[model samples]
Each structure stands twice: as C-alpha cells, then as structure tokens.
Target: MDKNKRILSFLISFFMVISFIVPINAEKDEKNIFKEILKDDFEKNSSIQEIDSAEQKIYMVGVEGESILELLDQGYDEEKANKIALDIQNKAIESIKSFKNVKIGEKYLYTTNGFSITTDRNTAKKISLLPLISSISEAQVYEKRVNNVRNILEIASIKKEYGLDGAGMVVAVLDSGVDHTHKDMNIDSDNVKLTEEIVNGLKSKNKITYGKYFSSKIPFAYNYADDSSNVVRDTLKERADFSHGTHVAGIIGANTKDGGVTGIAPNAQILNMKIFSNNPKVPGASEDKIVKAIDDAVKLGADL
Candidate 1:
C-alpha cells in the first residue's frame, strides 16, 4: 500500500479497537490522526492551532461566507439566508465524510458564519481544506448559567396566589434519560411507589416518557442495531452526561404529592425526548436525531 493508504489502515485499526473497548466521552476528543501524520504541515499550516491535549478534540467548522452573502445581497430574507447557510454546511459535512472516512457529530447553522460540525481536531483541520469550509476550531460547549429567577418571574408567588403552575402544558425535554426516581426531580406517578401519605393518596400518572436517540438504528452512531432493538435507559447517571437533561426537566415540571421538592411548574408534563446518552460517549446527538425529536415533540403537542 502507498503511504497515505498505510496511514489510513493504521487509523482504521486503532479506531476499531478503541471503538470497542473504550467508551466514548462526549466532552473529550480523540487524538488527531492527521495532525500526527502531518505534524510538520499541522505546524506550518496556519489553519489549525497547536494541538493542546487538554482541550476537547471536537471541532466546529464554519461555512464559506460568499454563499450566504450572495443570498443576502440578492435581497433574500433572513430565513433564506439561514437556509442557504445550512445547505452549505451540509455540503461541507458530506464532503468531509466522503473524503476523510470520518463521522461528523452535529451541524450548527445558527452561527453567524454559517454552520459548524464536530469531529476530532485533525479531521476538522482536514475539513478546513475543503473549498466550501471557512474555518475549524474546538466546539465550544457552554454551561447553562442560572441566576435567581424568583425576582424576574415570581414563580413561587404565582403558584401560591394565582395558581398559575403549569397545569395543562406538555414540555419535551431533549436530553439524557431522567433518573425517574429522584426525590427532588421526578414527579410521582403510577410507575413509582412513593412512601409519603400525600403522594400515595394521589394516583399521579407518570409524567415522563423515555426515548433514546443513540441506541436506535442510525448510520451515524457507532451502535450496531437492527430490527427489534432499543437502547436501555441509564437511570443511575453512571454515564458521562450526569443527568443534565434530568435537571433541566426538573426545573421545568417536577412535582410531588409525596411531600417532596416541587418545581415551578409542578403540574406541567415532561416528555423525555432523550437524544444524548453515555453508551456511545457522544457530545450530542446528530442533526437527524435532534430534528426527529423536535418533529416528534411538535406532533406530540409540546407547548414548550
């Protein structure tokens, strides 16, 4: 085999072994193969920054500006601009996958420059060379900042006085599976047996519906699934995600007849549109999974 083919063979072999033994971590990126192979180029090439082992290996690739600008200059609306940008990003992602034998994690069209894709840093660098791509960098994962909401919304007072607790609303939580047993987070329903006298009296129906995106049959995920297959829910939070979705759901609509903690919208319903999981260690779900979940949520009549 030629030199490039030999390197490809080595990468394929190494990734195949790691894919089996090591669980993927969504927050961490793997070693950059191209950077290692093209160490000299990676250094001389101004496109990619020096490899920082401590940084998350994931990368965000931007779409070329000319396409979006053309759409804008042609008197296209904001919606059209957004659509064109997404199309460009998709093209970039498809080209990268075809050229590099790599998997793209997600695409972001909401970015000002166009869209973004997540891959190991080196694969991102390779993608940057594509004519359609603008730039590639680490995927920035932001933490949801929380400040006191009581002053802005007066949720406690609303619940107490106006009885404005979310009594008739459906909220779809696109996240990791909820614990379904947390005292403060889970709403008491038929599935669980609560010891509290108040909770036992009310025949509360289980509020959360569990759905997994990763374990299901999809070409992007590493999971090998066929017909008659479903992903098992990880209720223990043993995985890397650490119940972020659960916490978000709790804030939205956790209630207790069992004399436990109550969320602001205690009466609201939670739809567990689970997209992220620990099994594959993906940072996030693919574009298709998220789109499908949102479609499902809309069909299910999600108010939020």
Candidate 2:
C-alpha cells in the first residue's frame, strides 16, 4: 500500500511539472516570434515622432516639406520626382514597420498602399507626436441666442408653482429642425418632456399626443376651396402657416438647456407641421391638414 501511494504521488507531481513547463515554453515561443517580427520592421528616426500605436498600425508625425525640398535641392528634376517621392515614402514606411498602430496623412505623399495620413492636431497629438498646432477650446453651443434668453430663473419659478410648466401641454413650432442632440434639448434633460413626430401626409395620423409644423399658404387655400370655397378660414390657417408658426414655436417649445436658444415653454413637446409652399417663397399650411392636426391635438389633450 505504501509503495502504491508513492507511485501515485510521483505520477501527480510529474504531470504538474509537465503542465507548468508546457505553458512556459509556449509563452517563450510567442515572445520570440513577436521580437523577431518587430526587429525586422522597426525604424527609429529623430525627425519622425511616433504619436500612437495599435496592433497593426502606428500614427507618426514627420517634419513637413522635408522630402519635397530635399529632392528638389538634390537636383532630382521632374524625371526623378516619382523616385524621390518613392524614397521619402519608403523612409516613412520604414519608421512605422515596428509600430503596432500607425496612421499616416495625405500630405506625407509617401505612405504605403492602404495607409493615409490625417492632419488634425487633436488626432496627431493623442498618439505622442508634437501637436500640429496650438489647441483651442471653444464653447460648442450657440452663444448669441443663448445669451439673449437669460430669464430661466423666472421660467423655473413658474414651473415650480403651477406644475403648468409644459406637463400635459403640446407646443408646435414650424422652423428649421431643432438640434435634438443639443444638451438643452436632449431627451434626458429636466426642463421638458419632449417628444418628436413627423407629420407627413394629411391622411396619416401621428401616434404622439401633440404635434405641429410650419406649412405653406398655397396648400391651405387649395384644401379650403375644395371643402367650401370659403376663403376666410383658409386665410387664417394660412396666416398660421407663415413664419409666425416657427417664431411662435421657438418661443413656446424650444429647449433652453441646449445653451443655444430658449423657449417660453421649454418643456412643451413640439409637433412639426410642414404644410407650406415646399418652396420657401410661399408660407402656409394645408387647411385640410391643419384642421385635422388641430383635431388630433385636441384628442392628444393639448393645452395649447
């Protein structure tokens, strides 16, 4: 029994040794392969600064105009321009051979096939090369209109007391499309519970509770004439179709958090109605669609 136990322990120890040795050899082999590959391709030049690296590519910044001027000064006429270009290109290629990640730009003119150079400084500096230029940080939001609407305090006060802010209300605007991605107008913001729905044809009904748009005058007149030939109501909806709808919508529904523009009711969901002269010259909504939309808004429980 003692001898059998000894043999069993020996076998277990042997297997353990084999397992450890196998993994070590495998890791060593991989390291050697990587080193060999890197040695064959890597080049270092003082003028070429490496900015970023990836497994398959490396981004580099090289002295601009170096190759072009050198070739010209060396008396390589147009006949040798292609050769000179090739040579300079080869130099850049050699520099990046060992780099795991590299991106070249168009101006390099001498990148390997499939490699292109990018000139943006933010991109270049990220990889460790000297920046192409000084960095400037500008506020991305629309500053002019943002500064004009500083009465958010009053708006907030109104919101707290009435719960009347924009809850259960639908404000429609007709204008250039809202920048839905703006910080102020982003769906997650607190000032408004905004929803968007496109009003395409008169027959199609939107699923959302409230919506509106800026439409043209010609369609409104046509629909009115078809129904009763009564020009009066056609003209009223026509008046609403004008740019006034857009301006009113901006005041009533534009998201203020976007830091560009603020609306009187920043929380109202805007419905964009496009009934106008498709050609910007004429502004009006189709009377048929306008009536339908107003009826739809009523069904959606629109406060405005």
- Among all windows of 10 consecutive residues in model 2, the one with the lowest summed lDDT is 137-146
**Which number leads on TM-score?**
1
- Candidate 1 CA-lDDT value: 0.46
Evaluate model 1: give its TM-score.
0.45
lDDT over C-alpha atoms for residue 292 of model 1: 42
Q: For candidate 2, write residues 53-125 as lDDT tens digits.
A: 2123222234322343356566876446546565655654455444434444322321211123333323333
Q: How far is candidate 2 from the true structure (C-alpha RMSD, Å)?
A: 29.1
Q: How far in Å is the alpha carbon of 252 misplaced in model 1?
A: 2.5
Count backbone clashes in candidate 1: 1
Candidate 1: tens digits of C-alpha lDDT, residues 1-304: 3443333233323322322111233455523333444556655664544555324354555566544446677788756775776677677666776744354653344324434344455546666667776665554332222233333244444455644455444555655545554555433333221223322232122121233222101101111111112323444445335455556656566676677666556555565555554555444444334444554454344555
